[model samples]
Target: MAGTSQARDGRMALSFILEKNGAPLTGTSGSLAIGEMGFIISKASSTSAFGDIPVGCFFIASASTTLKDGDSIQKVKPYFLGFATSKSLSQSKNVVDVTMDYDAATNNVSDGVVSSSGSISGSAITETLNMESGINILQSRFTSIISIDGSTIEYKEAQTTEKDILMLGWNFRDCKVGEFLDIDIVPALFSNLSKDASYGSSQTFNVDYTGNFSDENNFVGGHYIVKNVEGLLPSIARPQAAS
Candidate 1:
């Protein structure tokens, strides 16, 4: 018997075979979301020749950004990724081939977007908030790469302010200093709007995080919430540390 492996990251690729009688279930739809702006789904097909997955039944997708677990936003296609006709797959063929990157904010000096993310592969997507300007933000990077299982979407905790979402990203894991960990956005959000407005105005979330890398001090971690953050946009910036 051969063991199967499946893993993907923002700057990498993840290939897997999702078999369902070599076809989608009747009267059902299949789709996927990468991060805040990458999404695709299986094409609608109800044809089977006893051994062939039709190309019209599948398609390849292009995620404008990337994704991770606990992400609040996900980008998706109205339908397919690529086309395929391996209906007679040898047990299970690679039905889905995907790539992802973390999406970032546009035209902001102190803000940048995270393309995609994953806990797998010794890497993590990150963003830095410039508190100097006093921030008001909505959905910036809402993905969390919990473990190797990949990224998941994070939602507003019970009664959490939208401004506090940035703080929420660090809610889980809380790895100590010197311990390396990766966090990303949810990677899936319905299939249309990335996120809706709150109470008719652009909401805000403040994401302030600290990790004692030299030693284990105290990690204030667990479902950080983005409350009514002001002046911050929905993007994280990767900045060079000051010398």
Candidate 2:
């Protein structure tokens, strides 16, 4: 058999493939194509086609690169670095819950509007949210990016309202950051909304959401949960000088 050789140089395109239930789900190939928003220059398997793997597991693969024979490769994993915190993902389980930076205060700064009754109406084809000022403010910022029909409606989590939702972009990610990580946002739904209304205080609601991905993009990372998070290691790097 002829000796197989690969030459690697310049910038290499990296992708993370997802395996579900010890099998490869169709359509999840490229990182951004599948909504997996992170990358790292590491090689875990010789075959680009990863074998059967389970959920909650991550792997690094190189799609396009020139690797010469006898090249020494380092073991690296693609990850996202948060602004002020770091969680050991090795301990993370499937269906991990992440708290995003968007809050009532942030919404207020951005001038979002929220309604008291909170109503979400319109067919699944076209939906709207007539929220109280706070949520309205937050949703307004993402409306351009998350709306399916470009209409506005709102609903209280406590109130039993009819909701016909297809995919909602409840979170916001920067284009620059998304380009750097090569990931995108899948359709999302805001669930479990709760708020604290005091006698003389601003009502702050907790916005919990769920994310979905098709076969194209399947991996989820920190970038999906935080803002302006990019560069696997440098995204979280801090000063090392004496304090």
**Best by TM-score, which number?**
2
Candidate 1: misplaced stretches above 4 Å? 1-215, 233-235, 238-243
How far in Å is the alpha carbon of 174 misplaced in model 2? Answer: 25
Among all windows of 10 consecutive residues in model 1, the one with the lowest summed lDDT is 81-90
| Model 2 C-alpha lDDT per residue in residues 1-243, reported as the tens digit of each score | 111133322122111111222223222232222222222223334432333322222333323233332222222222211111111111122332343576433222322322111122211111234311223322332333243334553333432221211111122122234322332222223444444567775544343333433222333232232222344322212223101
Q: What is the lDDT of residue 53 in candidate 1?
A: 24
Minimal lDDT window, size 10, model 2? 81-90
Please provide TM-scores, in order, for all candidate models, with all chains considered together.
Answer: 0.14, 0.22
lDDT of 2 at 129: 44
Query: In terms of TM-score, how similar is model 2 to the real structure?
Result: 0.22
